[model samples]
Target: TLSEIATMAGVTPSTVSRALNPAASHLLSKKTSERILALCDHVGYRPSLLARGTATGFTYKVAMILHDMEKDLNAHDWNRITCATSAFLQESGYSLVLLRTSEKGTSMDMQVSHFLMSGIADAYITSPSMLKNNTLEMLNSLKSPLFVICEHGVPFPVSDGVLRSDADAFKQVWSRIPKEMHGKICFLSTINDNTQRLLTNIKRAAWDLGIDANNAISTLSLARTSKVPAMEYAEAYHQTKKMIKSFNQFDFVWCISDFFALGVKDALTECGRCPGKDVFILGYGDLETFPGVSEKPVLSTISANTHEIARNMCSVIMKKLDGEHTDIVTVKSSFISRSTF
Candidate 1:
């Protein structure tokens, strides 16, 4: 790491970023940089914003807006949003300013205006914040260039939606699963306006697959804790664990996320049912970065491509920002097929 950092810093494999990094901004003070950097070997330190900017002419700072900081501390859907945004922003030469209620002088939503107003960031992109939050509601009222990154659905004045690539696989999982596998299939998803968009896409895909999503029972699985429950592998497992144990007439289990799918897996295990084998289990948000139901013999899942989502969302925003759109451009989820069916 020191060697890598030194190479990046360019002084020597021994010169550390702390020595050269500007303390006023976000790193060590000049004196400290000189003290330790001179003595220490560059063991793989990363370039600080100020130093990198001087050379590249780019600070790469991105102002990422999210309502809850706790969500990142304890990952859930919010984590997915964070990862995707960071990956895309960095690839395009930007850093992130995680806007929360406290960071902004007054409110969370105001953080965007505050940062943009101050000219701290080159552009403002909307991070996945909950729809129910008061700050988020206020944000919705303002027409910010905020693009929806991994949003559950499109928000108002915020069209150009970006999300993971694996969105389309929901239907395939349902089709492979027998309608009779469970007495009634239960779909556990986050409760928000985004639900409609997700359901809309799923419904359309399901119809194409000859599956009627409207007929399916909807069981809500809001986040009780952002942390994925250990009882089952995913949130879907815990959300409907009781139902599964009661031998609830549900035939199949569907979840909006792999976190939930893991939950379903555990529930099935408890009920003596086989996931992907005897019973059908499905998950959205195919996380190649993180392991999910794909490894399970009976589980099927769709992986979301953050890269594609970001690219598409950015394209839509550039056009809209340029006054090129009369309405919003919707980005749907992609599909990843595993043996879970």
Candidate 2:
């Protein structure tokens, strides 16, 4: 059937073969490859994995380790980063081994060591739940090749490069808020470098604008555990809710995460205060679909643009593997202004 079709198209079986496989498609002209694929679809042609594998020395597999799939998927920047990284990895001729490192029994450190010990994957790209757990410190000490997705100490030992969130420079953006809004502004985030960086940056901005940073209090949520401790989120909700009560004048509430802020929003509603109307809410990591969630005080946020983050991490891996050394790169953040002013 292949030869018959190739003859009718005035092309050799080898041309058809090249068109059938993506790795070989470069040998065929773009139009020829397109026509071949179109005709192959008509004939239901598929490439044989066995032959392809023998030709290429690589199984083209990569292992990705993250803390929480829910948060990882729901998180705005990191989610986009992982998805984009996966796409790039696939197109670059590699498969993904997605590993949820911080499950109930498994420690993130152990997960990294185990994967490294297995030696099954070509390389590793890890987004250690730096905020959720204290794993980033430990993950840094490992001997394997790794890429970090968060900010920590100066440099990582095992990590040839780091891809950090641009939230560190967020203070620059927050500083631009009106001088009157400085004391009225509240910074939010879980206890992480990026969160602290956000606070530090804003506080500096606040100071420059003659605003008191103390007017804003930072509240940390559940540790980066496999599953957020049942009470951690609840306690944070209550604590923030309670803190909100102490404020006689709070104009803006900055939350590190949108999903987490949703919890805070719930607490505010319990107090009979309408969000966005009575209080403004700003969130980082524009993640979560807010499924079955109604519009209560529009939540404004900045997206982490993880697509670039992921791509950068992958590029770092490729460069390092090629004996190139580069400094860690930070991914840019995006802002969304909702009615939560």
Tens-place lDDT per residue, model 2, 1-341, is 66866886689988887787555689888999899888888877665555555665444567776666676665445556677888877665566787666643457647666765656465767664544565555444334466667653334545355545444345545654566565566665554434565566546655665556676444443434233423334644666666666432566677766755666677777777777777777766655433344445366766666667778777777666556776677666666666654
Q: How far is candidate 2 from the true structure (C-alpha RMSD, Å)?
A: 5.5
Error at 256, model 1, angstroms: 3.2
For model 2, the stretches where C-alpha displacement exceeds 4 angstroms are 1-28, 39-47, 66-80, 99-119, 130-145, 152-162, 167-169, 189-198, 201-244, 266-278, 288-297, 314-328
State each model's CA lDDT, in order: 0.54, 0.62
**How well is each residue in 1-341 modelled by candidate 1, as lDDT tens digits?**
55655555455543464354332223555665664555444343355566666765544565566566665434544565556666655544455676665433466546555555555554456544444453454444333456555444434544455544233566555566555542376666655424666667666767777666677545555545444333225445565665555435555666766766766677777878776666565676554345462444434566555446655655554455446763444455555555555
Q: State the weakest 10-residue window (summed lDDT) of model 2.
A: 223-232
The weakest ten consecutive residues by lDDT in model 1 span 17-26
TM-scores of the models, in the order given: 0.61, 0.68
